[model samples]
Target: MVDDRDLLKVVSGIIGEERTSDDCCMIKVGDDNIILSTDMLHESTDFPRGMTDWQIGWMSAAVTLSDVASCGAVPLALLLAAGLDEPERISGITAGAKDCCERFGAELAGGDIDFHSELTIVTTGIGRVEDEYYKTRRGAKPGDIVCVTGTPGCAGAALEGSERYWKNLVEPLPAVREGRLLAVAGVSSMMDVSDGIALSLYDLSGSSCVGFEISMDNLPLSPGVSPEMALYSGGDFGLLFTCGRDILPVTGVDCTVIGVVTDSGEVLCDGVLVERRGYSHRWMEEI
Candidate 1:
């Protein structure tokens, strides 16, 4: 079976490594750098059961904005394309997308609507950042501290029948403010933990050419969430970052230093190799 990351290698082959390396593609525009990203969500896959149309809309917008945030960019606008199963869903979806954008300092620009068998949404986000402020997943160095914002696994817990965490899964918050703060604080590398902390660490390791030594005891798990869920569950839109110890105690952000970078180029948890497992889309080869 081939996964999304394996398919990304094909994309990288065609687009060149520089273009395919980051969460958001960077384009130089005048004195600033513009970062652009897009995401697609479907009713059958991305959205969980019991999520309202409003939450569906919000989640669609959030996923893209989260990419923008990962680059430490200030979101400026978003374009939402809705393939609706029912026309009535548009109203709730639009309202939710607009509210999320407004709350995150972005605008919900006009978009396209089309009829479809299942509700689907495609969102494109545009953001701006100074050349010096933008962060990427390729700068971590040995000895840098690995940190993550907010408690992961809340969404995973919600999926496991925790009613208290339902909102966390349905309407996950993008760490836009925290990304900017981390960039200003000179974070070496940063990305969102939308794909679980374990997989995210591997992605960072691949890009930054460094390894991680994370302490399971230091992970900030949500109440009632197991260690496995916190490490491997998806849909947590928090920032995972690496920085120097001199920059300890980043202000105004709920982040925990869970590990440190190493030159070994392998991700380890409690002195053992961490498995490369997470929420990834997979396709089996026909035999």
Candidate 2:
């Protein structure tokens, strides 16, 4: 069976061009460059119980903008496509989208609308970057410290029926500021943990062709979150990065050193091989 990764490979092969697994695709325009990314949230798969329409709006924008920030791009605007029937719901979604843009300093330029059987929101983020400063998921080397921008696993906890963690799940704050700081700090490689940390580490390993030795004890966990949740939970939206030098102090962001890059292609958590157990599309179990 072809999984998501396999499907991407097949599509890339069909396109006949070298493509990246990076969250966003970048293009050079004149002296500078522009980055583009899109993300969609469906009510059936994404929306948790007891979430407000405002949070739904906010998260749709945040998820797409997270991709923009991961590439060290300054958000310019957002294009939204909302599918719904209720006018009130649409209003809340657009309002939340507007608020998200305001918070992140972007513009909700325009979007489309359609009525569908289920609610769906697709947002496209537009961002700009200096030609030399864009970030990617490659370039990690041996001796680099692997770090995460903020605590993780809250969303996982929420999925496991934690009411407190529900706030984290519905109203996620994208690490845009942290991503910008890491870009300026000259991070070797970085990505957001929208997927589980285990899958994320495997991705980084494959991209940079380097192994990682992560200390499970070093993972910065949210309160009431277990090791399994911290490792396999997705929707964290924290920035995970590697740098050859020590991390510089960033205001308002909690940076934690969790592991080190190695030449071997093994990803370990406290001397144990990290398993591929996470919020898979087929099964989002908290084991």
Candidate 3:
């Protein structure tokens, strides 16, 4: 195992921040502060050998940006850490990263370049929100309503019936606006879905120590996506949350209530606990 401590030590040193913020970090500078997150994409690890360079750049931004969204923070700037076999490929990578940043009202702050045989992208994202709106993976309470932003299984729908990806899912609505919508509406403890519903929900459950119950029938589905796949697939890039039960106001993409929080340490849907553990990078194919 690479271990979280060593990884954090190296990342904190390289990024110039000696502190660890757990899932999300905050620094106070008088009245204003900032939140930071970094994600890495390696050609040998993330991309298949025959993947297209154009999609590589776009996918890089999408994956990294998802982390920022998961923190329930609005992105402000993005920095690229790139290594490439072909220098010309940097342009495409930048363009893609820039496109994603621009879509979410974020800036392409700066980047580093290195020469290598395989392409890799490392993104450092900066985001901010008022002190009152720093949503994280915690704070969920018992009886809170569990909702998911937008339709699920977007990438799954794109790869329907095919185990391996052939094309990227259609670019969905950026979660920035959705976060803004939820923040202003006074919702907290939100995260964007990346590791599939069951896994991500399990994370929220563990973080809050409150079990969850989701109604399989109410789980939102994208066109042509299966319920199981939609529920357990990643790249949905949507928000999944457990909010107070006052019918609180929310904005941006539509959300569907899948379940509620419970006292037990288990998740149930339609009278059954989720049998599969859901998707993880280490078990995508197996899931």
Candidate 4:
């Protein structure tokens, strides 16, 4: 069966790989570069049964805004498209969306609505990035240290019906602040870990044409999370970056050095080849 990646590849063939592949599309606006990105959330697929409307809205907005942060851009505004048959929950969703944007120093500009059988939310974020602070997955070089903000495996634990991890899974807090900090510190390459780290590593490798050797002992795993879940589960929207020596101090967050870039064109986990896979829409259905 065709997956999201396969479909994206087809789209990339038409619009050019660079434009279609990146999380956000960049455009020159005078001396500054504007970043624009969009992400979608559906109730059946993205939201679990117990999630509140507030958490749903917050997560939807966070996912899109995270893309802007991944590009080292400061978010300015968001546009939301919420489709739902249950109009009563609209207020909760709106309130949550507004709150998240405000906390991140951004605005919930405006959006459209439609009626649907199930709830659906689509968010688009617009942000600005200074030329010098802009970063992408393409700049990783050999000898650069692979780093990550925050921890992983919480989402995976939540997926396995672990109540202890519900907050981290449902109310995901993206590393926007940390991302901007890394950008200013001159990180060579970066991306958010929406997919599993293994898949993300493969993506970084593909983009930069480099390899990675990850030390399993270095992974910052959440409590009760196995290495497989930490490596393969999704919904941990932390920033993964590659940078030179002399790591910059990211105030208010613990950044961990998990690995290093190599010329081997493979992703190794504790000196073993890790399978290249990650959670996608199709993968989510199986779960």
Candidate 5:
């Protein structure tokens, strides 16, 4: 018999070790602080077979950083859990991870490795945020404006076609400084567009019993990306936040008010219902 539940159990155990995603999961213990986020880049599942070792390594770090970034936590360090085919490949993976992490001002604190048939990189990041203006998904008001930074659906769109999606793999994540900027602006709430905007909105609206109203026409899609997919694509890695009804003044980062928070759980695209949510653990059978 196979133990399919083993991984789920272990993951639950690890997250349960502390607390998982609830009560906002934090501890004030001493000077060292912690914010836990995990991202797994499975070769077969996440990337196309022909992906370069460098892209694989870089993306492995970027995705995890997205979680930390959305939390408005200043990324301080990262640790890797890898399974490599050869000892030599470890150098490439480490170098790739180092280049990406350093680009974002985080350090390769430490990591562990084991041998495997295929390469697997799991990144765990730890960061700390000041008590003041620490962003959360919990504070959006009914009339708050829904704003997003940079373009939407770039990462996901880049993965779709020959010319565009591949090019974005190397495009540095627009995180770090921008997230801090939004927080200081006294934004009501924030989250990164890791999963499509739709799923992310629901995740952020958790327990608050608040829903979101999004204007699809206002969605900022990258030139190479399509609007049809932008509405529900994942991996964009842009910041989606809520503020007052009007767009806030910002520099360096492009901001747009694409929606408004509401008391109902239904999400609308210019007053119409949207289908085909975000990503799935299985093949993307579009809804």
Candidate 6:
């Protein structure tokens, strides 16, 4: 079976590696750089059961904005394209998207609507950041400290029937403010931990050419969340970053240093090999 990352190789080949390497594409616009990102979600896959139309809409927008935040950009606008199974779903979806945008200091500029067999949404975000302030996934150095914002596996716990984390699953908030703060603090590299910490560490290792040594004891797991779940569960939209010790005590963001970067390209947790498995769409080979 081939996973989504394997398919990304095809996209990288077609669009050029430089373009597909980062969370968002950077384009210079006068004094600031415009960062753009897009995400797609479907009713059957992305949204969980019992989620309201409004929550679905918010999730669709939040995912893309999380991408923009990973780039250390200030979100300016969002464009949503909704494909609804029922026409009435459009109003609630639009309202939810708009409210999310407004909450994060962005506007829901425009979008497209259409009928489809199932509900689907595609959101595109536009953001701006000064060239010096924009961050990427390719700058970690050996000895840099590894950190993550917010407790991971909360959404996964919610999925496991923990009502305490329901909001974290349904209306996950992006780390836009924290990303900017980390960028200003001159962090080496940054990315969102939407695909679980283990996979995210591998992605960062590949990008930055460095490995990570994480301590299972240091991971800030949500209450009652197991270490295995914290490592592999997805939908936690927190930021994973690397930086030097000199930048400690980054104000205004609740982040925990869980590990350190290593020059050897091997990811380890508690001195054992961390598996490369997470929330990814996989396809089996045809017979």
Candidate 5 residue 124 Cα shift, in angstroms, is 0.9
lDDT of 1 by residue, 40-136 (tens): 8999989999999899989888989999999989999999999999999999999999999999999999899999999989999999988777999
Q: For model 2, how does the per-residue alpha-carbon lDDT over 92-180 read when each residue is reduced to its tens digit?
A: 89899899988998999999999988899999999998755688888889999888877889998998899887878888898888888
TM-score on alpha carbons, each prediction = 0.98, 0.93, 0.84, 0.96, 0.86, 0.98
Give per-residue CA lDDT, model 4, range 1-287, as digits (tens): 55687778889889999987678999998888999999988999898889999998888888888889999999999998999879988888988888889888789999988998989999999999999999888999999999888888788889899999999888888778888989998899999988988888888999899999998889998789987887888888998899997766666657889999999999999899989777785534421
What's the residue-level lDDT of 109 in candidate 6? Answer: 99
Task: Compute the lDDT for candidate 4.
Answer: 0.88
Q: Candidate 3 on 100-159: residue-level lDDT in tens?
A: 888887888899999988777888888876777777777788878889887777666654
Q: List the RMSD of every prediction in angstroms.
A: 1.1, 3.0, 4.6, 2.3, 4.3, 1.2
Superior by lDDT: candidate 5 or candidate 6: 6
List lDDT for all candidates, in order. Answer: 0.92, 0.85, 0.71, 0.88, 0.71, 0.91
Candidate 3 accuracy as lDDT: 0.71
**What is the full ranking by TM-score, best candidate first?**
1, 6, 4, 2, 5, 3
**Model 2 misplaced regions, further than 4 Å:** 16-18, 85-87, 250-252, 283-287
What would the per-residue lDDT of candidate 5 be over residues 95-200, giving only the tens digit for each residue? 8778878988899889999988877889988778777757777778888888888777776766676466664544437477788777776787887776778766
Choose the strongest candidate by lDDT. 1
C-alpha displacement of 148 in model 2, angstroms?
0.6
Clashing pairs in 4: none
List, residue by residue over 108-167, the lDDT tens digit for candidate 6: 999999999988899999999887778888999999999999999999888889899999
- How accurate locally is residue 228 in candidate 2, as Cα lDDT from 0 to 100? 86
In model 4, which regions exceed 4 Å deviation?
283-287
C-alpha RMSD between model 3 and the true structure: 4.6
